[model samples]
Target: MTPQLLIFDVNETLLDLSPMKEGITKLLGNPNAYEDWFSILIQMAMVETLTDKYSDFGEIGAAALTMTSQKHSKSISEEDLKLTLHLIKELKPHPEVKEALEKLKSKGFRLVALTNGGRETLEQQMNYSGLESLFDGFYSVESVRKFKPHPDAYHHVLKKEKTSPEESMLVAAHAWDIAGAQQLGMQTAFIKRPGKFPYPKGKKPPLICKDFTELYMKLTVDA
Candidate 1:
């Protein structure tokens, strides 16, 4: 069935993260710095969720960056870390994002963004991307003090929107996010952005697209 609500994963899915990746790699003087830090950030976020604890996503990112630097035998100042990470708030949308979003909105689909980032940062990122006006709402997992892939995170959106799992679909580039929503019985779309892949062990997403334009095409037909 076609979904009534379309939930988007902001970072890396709608907005491109390559700029921030470049900044992070340059800061740490290591080509693998961004990937390493992101891996740690996700792991620590899950650690918080599993332990019934809460911490700001930005704080986790900073801590992860520090750990990555240390692992590389490099020392980074707090000032530099913050500066480099701030790049996240200035990301640009993927080339096809704006047009696709507009098309989806015109088709009367409720669009919302759900991210693990802090609320203030999520707002800044959206506004800065010039795609802010296209969404019906912007949500941060901060409200529930949990990160994505945790049922509470997804539930927060569904509860706030008053949309049922079966009536809503999650569109994201991350396999873990797709798996989480799929397990909850929500419709799922796996965005196959470059360097991202589907989870082989998870249930297959009903829609897998190379970008938002493709997603718009498939969703239009489905609707």
Candidate 2:
């Protein structure tokens, strides 16, 4: 069934992270450093949720960068770290993102963003990408003090929107996010961005498209 509400994941899904990747590559002199750092950042965020500790996503990112730098026998000054983190707010949407979002909106789906980033950061990201007006609402996991892949985050969005799990579909590039939403009985669409793959052990999403354009087609024409 087609969903009444379409929940989207930001960061690497809708917004491209290549700019941030370039910054990390310049800083660490390794083209792969950005992927390593991002992986660690997600791990650390889940650590906080599991340990019952709370830290803003930005703080966790900084800490992860520090740890990653230390692991590579490099030291990142506070000023440099802060500057790099600021690049997140300046991310641009993927090439097809705006058009696909417009297509979805024109079809009358209620679009919302549910991210692990803080409210202010998400706001900046949406505005910078010029997609802020496309969404009906923006939500952050900060409200529940938990990150994505946690059941609470998905439940909170469902409750706030007053939409049942079956009536909503989550669109994300990450396997973990899709798995979490699946556990809550929500439909899911996975966008296969470059180098990203779904977890082998998780339930496969019903819709797996190459990009936002393909996803839009699958949802609108094929569904």
Candidate 3:
């Protein structure tokens, strides 16, 4: 089926977060802190899903921060935690992200954001990127309190978009996100950005391109 809609993974896909790696290392302790924090965040998010609990993304963020800090015998002020979350909302988009989304939107596919961020943070990030106006709607895992890799997160997006998995495309830079979406029967497109991954969880994306510009060419969008 021709795709009528495209749902984007928000974090590493649209935003460039290489800076955060440094920020967290200095602030938290380990250079690999982002990965550690992110892993725990996902674990907690999934825990919420497994136990039928739902919390805002911000709450999950705070809990994850507290847990990680406590485990490492480090300290993080509440203000610093707020600042870190704010950084996410204020992140800059990837250099090519806006142009890519513009090209995709002009081709008549409805664009939506599917993220693990809270709705408010997602909105702020979108507006900061100046790509907010291009998106038709935003959906987040906050709706289901589950992080990526959980089928419910992807399923929630599919249901809200009112399209079958086959009729929609999931475009992401994270292989795990791609995997989860694919498991929900959604067609996927991978944008192979540096530091991103592409190994599939179940099958794989039907198309993988170096960037959205190449993706546009494959879709044959008239310039």
- Candidate models: Cα lDDT each: 0.93, 0.93, 0.80
User: By lDDT, is 2 or 3 better?
Assistant: 2
Clash pairs of candidate 2?
none
Q: Rank the candidates by lDDT, best first.
A: 2, 1, 3
TM-score of every model versus the real structure: 0.98, 0.98, 0.87
- Root-mean-square deviation per candidate: 0.9, 0.9, 2.4
Model 2: per-residue Cα lDDT over 1-223, one tens digit each = 8999999999999999999999988877788789889999999999999999889999999988888788777777888889998999999999999999999999989999999999999999999999999999999999999998999999999999999999999999999899999999999999999998889899889999999999888888954
Candidate 3 lDDT over residue span 49-121, tens digit each: 7787778867887787778778777898988877775667667887877887888888888999998888888
TM-score of 2: 0.98
Please give the distance, in angstroms, between residue 185's alpha carbon in candidate 1 and its true position after superposition: 0.5
Query: How many collisions per candidate?
Result: 0, 0, 0
> lDDT of candidate 1?
0.93
Model 3 steric clash pairs:
none
